[model samples]
Structure formats: structure tokens, C-alpha cells
Target: MAKLTIVASIKVKSDQVDFVKSQLENLVPITREEAGCVQYDLHQDNENPAHFLFFEIWESRELWQDHTNNDHIKAYQAATEGMVEEFVLHELTHIA
Candidate 1:
């Protein structure tokens, strides 16, 4: 099976950018240690601090689904509640 690629974009409230960034940073170490996580990277827009993106590669969609259901993910959701202005995620196929 083809590996799963995920592109997630997040926009935080103007006033909560720093706090949101810290929370996002906290997730990286933990997520990178999860099963099937080939790569997990986080990026912030240079000009727009409130904009954040995650580029992730997983061994399979099922494993990625497991990741979404993990306790850490749930905690992230709860911690950032109301601070996120917009959230978008895409699952992609590596066509090459």
C-alpha cells in the first residue's frame, strides 16, 4: 500500500498566536515517536505568525487514523479550543 501524506493548515486567533504555537510545538516530539510516523514537521508562515502548517507522512491511512484518535491529539484539541480560527487537512497520494 502507498504511504499516506497529510497536509494540515491552521490559523490561530491573532491574540493567541504565541500560545497556539507553543501548544503545536509540544505535539511534535510526542507525535514523532508514534507508530507509522515516517515524518512529522511543523512550519509557521514567515509573514503571518498566526498561520501554521503540518506536513506528515505515515505508513498507512489506518495508522494515521489511529494517530488522530490518540490521547495527545485529543489533548491538543482541548487545549487549543476556541483559539483556532481555521483548520484544514488533506490526505494525499504520492503519485510519483
Candidate 2:
């Protein structure tokens, strides 16, 4: 079995950056505690306050899917509804 890595890129409305960041911050600890979560880190772009990224490593794709279905993640989606301008998820298949 191979571990899966995911990078979630998000851009929030300029005015809502701080609020959205706070919401994202709350998910970090909770997500890190989930089963098969090898690493879950949140990062904000140094120059673009509205841009946020999440780097996650999971034991398997199924486990990562489970994490996405968790309650806190749902809450995050609900809370940030229209505040998010763009949300893109990329699954990285590390080569080398």
C-alpha cells in the first residue's frame, strides 16, 4: 500500500481572510487526530493573505476520503460557504 498526499488550495474573499483562516486553524488539530493521518499541516501564503493551503499525508486514499467526510470538515465547509472564492484539491503521486 502506498501513502497518499493531498494539497488543498483555497482562496477566500479578501475581507474574509482572517475569519476563514480561523476556521481552517480549528480543523488542523481535529484532522490530525483522525485515523491514518500521517501529516496534516496548514499554510498561508506569505504575500497573499487570502490564499491558504493544506498539506496532508494519509496511509491510504480511503482513509483520506473518510477524513473529508468527518463532521468538523463539514462544519468548515458550511461555515465558509460563500467566503471562499476558490477551492481546489490536488492529489500528489510522488515520484522519486
Candidate 3:
């Protein structure tokens, strides 16, 4: 199967950036432990502190679905609920 990529852009509330980052850090271990995760990284925009991006690569769409329903991920979603300004998710297929 071709690799699946998920790009998520998040805009966080000003004072919530630090807390949101901390929560994202907790996701690292969980993502790494997942069966089909290839890469899962979080990045902060250098010029815009409120901007955050999640770059994720999975072995298959099924794996990505699993990640979405995982308990830790659910917790992360709940935790960030009110602290986010905007959240956009993009799913992609590898071309190379």
C-alpha cells in the first residue's frame, strides 16, 4: 500500500501555546508505539507562535484511522478542545 500522510494545521489561543505544546509532546510516545505509524512530528511556526503543524505518515489508511480512535488521541482532542482557534486536517497520498 502507498504511504498515507496527514497534515494538520492548528491555530492555538495565545496563552495556550505552551500547554498545547506540552500535550503534543505526550503524543510522541503514543504515536511511536502505534503499529503502523511511520512518522509523527509536531512543529511550531518560528514567526507565528500560535501556529502549529502536525506531520504524520502512516503505513495505511486503516492505521491512520486507528490513530484517530486511539485513547490517547481522544484525550488529546478533548484536552485541546477550547484552546484551539482553528484546526484543519488534510489527508494525502504519497506520489513518490
Using Cα atoms with residue i matched to residue i, what is each candidate's TM-score against the true structure? 0.98, 0.97, 0.95
Prediction-by-prediction clash tally: 0, 0, 0
Write one digit per residue (lDDT tens) for candidate 1, span 1-62.
89999999999999999999999999999999999999999999999999999999999999
lDDT of 3 at 85: 94
Candidate 2 residue 90 C-alpha distance from true site, Å = 0.5
Model 1 CA lDDT for position 35: 95
Q: CA lDDT of 6 in candidate 2?
A: 99
List the candidates ranked by TM-score, beginning with the highest: 1, 2, 3
Please report the candidate that would top lDDT against the real structure.
Answer: 1
Task: Return whichever of 2 and 3 wins on lDDT.
Answer: 2
| Clashing pairs for predicted structure model 1, backbone only | none
Q: Which whole-number lDDT from 0 to 100 does residue 86 have in model 3? A: 95
- Global lDDT of each candidate: 0.97, 0.94, 0.93
**lDDT per residue (tens digit) for residues 1-96 in model 2:** 778999999999999998999999999999989999999999999999899999999999999999999999999999999999999999986556
Where does the lowest 10-residue lDDT sum fall in candidate 3?
Answer: 24-33
